[model samples]
Target: MTMATYKQIESLMGTGPPAGAKQMQVMRWASKNPPKDPNASFSGKNVLITGSNTGIGLQAAIKFAALDAAKVILAVRSPAKGEEAKQKIIAATKRESAAVIVMQLDMSSFESVKTFAVQIQAQVDRLDVAVLNAGIAPPKYATEKTGWESALQVNVLSTALLAILLVPMLKDTAAKAGRPSQLTITGSFACQYVQPDELKLSPGEKLLEKMTSPEHFNVEKSYGQIKLLTQYVMKGLVDDYSYDVNGQVDVAIDVACPGYCSTDLGRDFPWYIALPTKLMHLYCARTAEEGSRSLVSGTLLGNAGHGKFWTNDVFTDPGIMVTSDEGKKLQRQAWKEISDICKQKMG
Candidate 1:
């Protein structure tokens, strides 16, 4: 294997299951801790982070600003909240007024994602980093404007559509800037918790119907399946653009997991689930800033980290389902299906 590939596999193998006490200690340590900034200056760079109104997305925006990115766009669902976040990032970084811009984007709707893309492409001359950080964990089964389960719509469908639209923009920026460009999507380690059977949707079956049926709908498993399927999508991206001309990928795409963080991701869930999750966050979860380090590192790692899955700032294999023979075949199949749907449904 290539050195980078070997490193990835080695990292995965080295991460054996955590011991109970050690895991607890890690959690307790993360409780209110924020990651220290790497202090990598951005100079002339422009960054776009979705769902930046709060949580890790917001902190990633702050880091990009603190590093001196010329422009940082907060692509959030609420312009008001985005503007509010913009003020905080500016004050935190002591950057200029135009350092952060607010734009509206709702991940549950393909139309909104499209409009956001068009607006950014029109306004921003370059996109050095595009962090697709907005996603949800549904508390119950619910369909969205995209006619899929809420988690699938926001986490998979709309995310893929945004990537489809933004990858070319990143390529253009890379060519112009004479440096690597990054499209980092916020992923979850929850993929490891997915049961094999949870990923068993047949290729030709109606995925939304089968996966989101209320009679059998499961919030945790649904989130897990969406995350597991996302690995296939990531594999497809790496394989599709594995080759780069002139020794650098035009655009480097990767996924990073923030570990468990205190974010609004569980906002849609019921009290019982949300309350325990909050308590866990209060006691064991990484502060949103600490979680955001993976997001920032994933964005800035450039070509060495291309098309890899990263967590805790290191490249690693996505998991067993992304490595097995059967899983690889299914990944291709799932990518074809997802791509076809994007062609049909997106603006």
Candidate 2:
């Protein structure tokens, strides 16, 4: 039998298959060849992370608390789980009075997202960094609480809605502070695996309905399609976030990937896929702590990071296909149509 490395497996089955090896090449490189130094503290900053109950988000909360952040809000589907995660973070960091708190946020629901944003506006004086990190990978037939496919609701629609709601808050904060505030959408390597055929539909009233139909359901392709659509939302709306409601550039908005990490995002994996995946997680996946470092580093970038896709602690091409001339044309066309749909659908 041929032994499987990350790349070898990807070559055989596009991005993820055999339900194991979720592309560890970037993470393996990041782990073995770590960065030169620790990026510095987030002291006095009010940082918020969605899905902070476990995995990379949990690690990020710990580090920000250790750095003496004024507030570390855990935005999660369950306040109970968020509180539990907060306790663990306090125990790990021993940062008593870190002001780490749990705020309920169900990313699959538009109502929940709006309420969370309003609560932020009411309570927090400033938001130094907002990390949009919650996401899901559903089984072929899974659906979110909102009735859309699980990947579509949790990963794209609700997440984008929350980002749009938070824009003014980030902008107002940037305007108040000399430095620009940050809004980072946790991105994925899945963005690299898309093809034009996957999104070749012309602008039409029913395009979203057509694309998301169960008839198009293919387990292997669903997750990547969600990530690709997410990138489009990031690219399409990032510019708007850069400028405030007054149209002055006061915030930095970008997407960041933590590479492949062992996380609960794959909670929906079937037993067969899940069993072998445990082995791959042990050998290939970056520990959540290691992955979280990449995400936290993104909040520290300057103007160079505006509207860019960041990974491995650097701003680099999200994909060849996403940046090519033809790609640019496609992105623009997709953005024009999708933006309108997103506004209408999200409303």
Candidate 3:
């Protein structure tokens, strides 16, 4: 068998079935119940969720509130919409009005993310759970003010910046509580389907630079590649940055994939793209509330889930592109490129 065929077989037998088989497995996934832990409690913990104004993020916020998190910070690009979400969570859970805080966080802008981090530093002493859930899948290619592609800026750079900036708080909280804190980034199952051919690179051409170029933009492909990079960033943080002064891991970093949820993530898709997605959603997609279970459950994993992927109430392999030798080399390159961008932006 060819190497590509071997990889596909390995994926099917051990890791997961290939993405072309996703439709066939949809019924199984849809029929499978989401997880619930009656004993799970976040009574005094502060849970922060970006993009909490709608969809899976909003549902996760509601779940956190219902579970009695002391504070649920809804960090969104729009404070007004966030307030509406807060009211909804309060009304649903009957939690105190003061338990939910709406904070502004514009992931498209690095400056906005920095200001929001400063506000977070001033507001809380210990952050127990932070879900970096904000992301975009624009059908059109665009660049943010930082001159990076829009998805690269929002989904990767800003996500990394916010995670690193919050590390001190996570570590401090973990040290005080004597348990590792949770840091879960919203990832996607699409990353698994990223073909090796799509990632072919010329010698000396950096992965991030090639992916972000306008000439090579394809929304679906880029989205998968970006999510693959998200996994890399999560792994890099777990391997290098999440330890405390004592050399023990103080924060658990993992990626949560809310499988094929019926969210507005493809709101801007062209007719050709949107139609098939709509059909798929009609037939197979989970509700936002159902999908949010992965996000809430992932935070409950703590240290066991560091550098792992959580979905459908189980820890599964991320993908071939995230696990193969070729992937390791590319992940190192991507991590370096992302860290450099983050350092410059943070400085």
Top candidate, metric lDDT: 3
Residue-level lDDT tens digits of model 2 in 217-299 = 67777777777767777787765457655665577777877777888777778988788777877766777887787677666
Model 1: residues with Cα > 4 Å off, grouped in runs: 1-36, 202-209, 241-248
- TM for every model, in the order presented, reads 0.88, 0.85, 0.91
Please identify which of the two predictions, 1 or 3, would achieve the higher lDDT against the true structure: 3
lDDT of candidate 3 over 8-92, digit per residue (tens): 3233221233345564484345435443422367899999999999999999999999989999999999999999999999999
State the weakest 10-residue window (summed lDDT) of model 2: 9-18
Residues 82-189 of candidate 1 have per-residue lDDT tens digits of 989989998898998888889999998888988888899999999888888888887877889667877778888788888888877888888887766888888876
- Estimate the TM-score for candidate 2: 0.85
* lDDT on C-alpha atoms for all candidate structures: 0.76, 0.73, 0.85
* TM-score pick, better of 1 and 3: 3
Q: Residue 315 lDDT in model 3? A: 73
- Which candidate number maximizes TM-score? 3
* Ranked by TM-score, top first: 3, 1, 2
